[model samples]
Target: MTSIPDPVEGPGASPAVPGAPPPQLVRSPLSDGEWHRLHPLTPLLRGGLFLIVVIGIVFANLRDRLVFIFLPWLAPDIEDEVGEWEGAGGDPIDFIIANNLYVLAGLAVLAALIVLVAVFYTSWRFHTFRITDDDVEVRSGILFRTQRRAPLDRVQGVNLTRPMIARLLGMAKLEVVGAGADANVKLEYLSTANAEAVRADILRLASGRRLSAAGPAGALAPPRAGRVATLSQTVGREITGLIEGPEAPVTELESVVHIPVGRLVASHILSMSTLGLLFAIVAIVIGVSQGVTWLLFGFVPAIIGFGAYWVRSIVRSLRYAIAPTPDGVRITFGLFTTITEIVPPGRVHAVEVTQPIMWRPAGWWTVRINRLTGRSAADGSTDQFTTALPVGTAADVERVLRLLQPGLPDDERALVVQEGMFGPGETDTFTNTPRRAWWIRPLSYRRNGFRLTPDALLMRRGIVWRKLVILPLARLQSIGLYQGPLDRASRVTNVRAHVVAGPVSPFLAAVDRDSALALFDGVARGSVRAAFTDRTHRWAQEETSAPEPADLVRGAESAPAGASESAASGTGEDRT
Candidate 1:
């Protein structure tokens, strides 16, 4: 481990370059520049690559050098013992350490030079930054110092990182992302005050775009300075707001939601699986007392393992929020070291809403978005954040879906409601004795819907939680779609509903074979073209196909009693 270097003191310490307000100092145990130091694994990454390259180069040049050293040792080895080769080679160690000196010295110098260049570049070119009212400026560069600027509108997201060193340094590196930012924008390094000040000012300056929570109770933001008394306009107002009013900034924090204290602890620590810190701690204590230091170390981290896990759980389980902005969506999580992510809505190509076996009863949902460019955790990367709500309920999902693609069909509100019983809703809904079905496989067919006809059977079954994946003919990616052998033998044919999932982003859903072929022909032959076009086609300006018929019963399923406001109110009660 390297020793701590002295601070930049004495003569050449540059003055605080004028820019945004200096970062406010917070009471924290880490040191300046502690955040940017490479992760312990960093050197390994570079060193591993270097080792390969260096070895290849050394081996390439080894023959000539080997001959030079071996000439002297050849006589001794040949006389003393049966040499492997015809020559008497010199003392292996002596020869190796001798002539290898030049090669070693050259390597050392090259490495030292590379290190010097990198450090110089880092010191001179590196800088942290913030956007100010007048301009978005940066202080960066190593040997050749620089301070550059652009307009605030040109600025995009501000990424804050605390490299392992930065964590220890008590300071953070800030990068102001923009359309065309410099490669190395680490402007001001190792300055805790500068970081916070820069971050706050940038936030305040662009305060116009701060994210807010959804719903009536969410943001208590005051009206803008000029628009306070414009209340009864007799219509609706679509004014855009960036930063919310003063009251709910903490709501900007995603970890503010209240999880039942008991469940939060249990889910993260002491559930039946017992894989959380409780198990680790219990195991650690037992191992340590038994004088099994190696074993204890094997399971848990020495100084900070348990704390990290606890902190991670708190960050995930608390106040969760997903907001839609004009440009993109910003998702923030964590408490001590908060993470704020910004993803543009335009780039979003697909979305996945999943409920795992355990989460089914919890009424929790997790969503993941497929962006054309940004990295996703689902595929595999450090960036696994959801573009929309990653965790929430049916209502939350609805709100986010609406936000994701505004102006979606209002009539589909009922479709969304119908899906409540249909999807992974609250646990009590499924307590009516799980149904068992027998078909190709026991678990494959969970339930049977009343046969609309003998030739067709509606089967609903899943290994874990049951799902009703519907398939309709009109949305097939391939009209000539066919069924496989397994499906045909069961007298059941699997047909795809849509090649995609979602109103905005569609995916394939498999259904029985008879339904598949029938639907395919119906759609392919354009038999249901007129009706299908009218209902599913959002872009068409075609009029309603037929006149509306009066409801025979007042509270019929076709027309329910209360409005959406009432439904929302009932769901809102338990959300908090």
Candidate 2:
């Protein structure tokens, strides 16, 4: 219940020394460990429109009855003539009108409005959220109350979403993504400015940074206009954003990658979904020509569904852009309902770069990652959530990869793009599937391979639909080597790196048996070492002069003597 500071008169209000930089004012009011209500118009914004629609539908259905009830004097002459018709079919409302109980009916309507207002007011009052150093908590409901909390350490990422309606009202929602499924906590309908400030405060707290005290003397704070002026400014900004685009919450670094509309449209047109739709349409055409009319019913529904999905996909990627920030990667997407997701360092478990055969001509690739989204499959579109780069050229992919994996050295970045993405089996760096194993993977034998770096494991596969998966050692949960009868006969093995559940699959198929064994040993030992030395979880607190990539690679290669023994006895099962 603490009052927010008056921006013009609070700390940092006076002018500082002539040459000194302006002091940074504390912008967040909700981070003071007090339970705070959401936006004042949250109730109306959340369901007011729905309530109006429901009332409109009811009035439409009972238009005549309502007219008679409210204005009985006007319809008095017609009622007597239709009394017989009404007696047989009319309900309690008609009886009320017939008895001239207009006051009673009006009272009933008034009562309903009162109840609705009370409910909405109480709901808004009860629904409160609190932000502390440890976690973000939200409490709601009157009868079946529920409380949800997201711990700072377990926070996977933070998403700020502005739906079309909410954006019009200059409001945004904050979803604090936790480490496990369905663990996300949402603060719906906060003022846009406050939402941005709260997001920064939460991320700062999660990053192990303490809030600064009020500014020193002569440090002038930014001026603030009156509430009326502020409201006008917010409205203006929202209107401007509709024509332009939503502004980013944080200061983005240079070199941001933006996908072109033409490329996005073309990529989807040549996608597997489009191809499947084409085949379905051909089948439908053939069926129609063969005098099968019943197929049209099914085909129409399928077409509608496919069209809807395709359009949604394109709309979501309309304003797609990705850039780096001090926290991690900032990804913005969507045309109407803009979502800005901040994925901090060390959250990404696995990264995959894939190229469909059709996209190969354009040298375009799609990048996705495996990370804890704190949402179930049924909650939302997990595909869109996991996709980092929807459709971009090879250069765009490289730039996005750098943002996603900031620790990756220049040499490793080249290895990822050159060897993992486009290189053939002739490279010495990658341990490829042996020629004897060609029968099992005839099409991709020359392209299938795996490479190791100090920070991650890279698995490249497929010729028609090329894929490269990168799994960071620190995030790896377990490693496994599989060899079935066919694999053994082909003198090859399959390796899988287990991580969080997501879109990226880390399984590599058809690797030379000896190379697979060596990979298993190295990964097991290196993962253990990486886990021990990993400091990315609290990156802000880590030492500035970290080891170079080459030194780390060398250290991984010449791991301690105990590392090998531990890895040999570890749970990396090599099943035959």
Candidate 3:
């Protein structure tokens, strides 16, 4: 691996030319393994904007008081009004005015402003992050210091987020997602170019690939430009993005699927949440008309909250796209505050394709996955992180799935979407529940079944809210079979494939007893075989010398049959 050349060194350097701009100095912080400070404007972008807004509100409210104290000549002519206002409260401004401490007050405000500026500047200076071959680390503190690290090998994904304000400033944030809850480390407010460059570096390192002799393409930071030129370029790009769409990061491949605006809006409108909102409105109108006028207080706020949530959901999905990259699948979404998430190969534990009863008419479906993002639901944005395809047609779902699970064979991919999600039990390849199990799930019994493939296990269930769950053999942690009293009497069982904690549930209910036994046995042996042979965690290595799809399946099939049966029947559980 060769060190990246500094912009001022070797070929990057140029002789001075009269009347021409000087050469720009570009630095590659990621390659240096040294602690680097965030953007100088980080504090302002993070919290100073909110502080400015708060100050503006306070200043507006105290406008008259300020005028009376500093500009008596411009004060309102209503002396009685001033007296009445002063008499109503023990206000600090009144005390300052009464004591004629105007100079002191001015000094105090100026001192506070100075202190605030110092805090912001100090905060920006103290907050620094570094990237190395093994981990990404961040350190921050004023008095109570804190440090966080995300190991490159354990990284689940990397996300680059550009909030609206930060986007306009040509800045973005990078989050290196760890495998455990609340384990993510973030580097907030880097230049857009640097953020993208750092993101590429992290993913590249995590993929077990060294920088090539020529240096990774994304490692070369753009030449730093003059402030005026930089600002103009940032604004121009932002305006263009608003009209067209966010520009694809250099690391992203061409999108595998594109979700149209019309389709996205229609999907949300037809959702059960929207239907519930409509019903609530109807009920509220009826209640108000029938002498319950007080309902307005609650109804108004409820409507606003629901409308805001709905609109936000739609907006966040506006520029949604999924693409394959060298390191993983890159999912990009959001209209204004764009986010690009890179989910590396083998990090995904499970995949699910679902369709609500309402969506069936329009042939729309959604795809979600089980992956450790190291963020809990409290983050509020976890849903966006887990959703691979928010809403799309069957073909769109297939394309997204192929990008997400590249090892899945072409035939298996077709079976997953066509048979696993939409096929009837009789004609599909899945081993479906027997008719006797109909009593357990009357409506969905015909659709409920499980299919075992070489690389994954597909479980299809639900009629009104259809779902197809795909759990890769390599990621399966454990397998269990359950038979409640009712299931025992019906000669049926439930099978659960446990993986990392995530939104997708990989459990199939009401499976025939014998079929469940076989599934348990097969998965027990297959998971072990797959785990031993799985090299996807170091995806770059696999990419360079990967076996054929058929060979992978064949490799997983060679596990001893006796070991699987014994493991499955003895404890009624198999731990991978």
Q: Write model 3 residue lDDT over 233-293, tens digit each, in one string.
A: 9988987887686655455656778788898889989988888888888888998999888
Q: Which is the winner by TM-score between candidate 2 and candidate 3?
A: 3
* Candidate 1 TM-score to native: 0.41
Task: Give the runs in model 2 whose Cα sits over 4 Å from its true position.
Answer: 1-26, 59-106, 210-233, 253-255, 285-291, 425-428, 542-576
Q: What TM-score number comes out for model 2?
A: 0.84
Show model 3 residue runs off by greater than 4 Å: 1-27, 63-79, 210-223, 248-253, 542-576
TM-score of 3: 0.88
* Tens-digit lDDT track of model 1 for 195-245: 544443443344333223111211122333433233222012211111121
For residue 414, what is the lDDT in candidate 1? 36
Model 1 weakest lDDT span, ten residues long: 567-576
Worst 10 residues of 3 by lDDT: 17-26
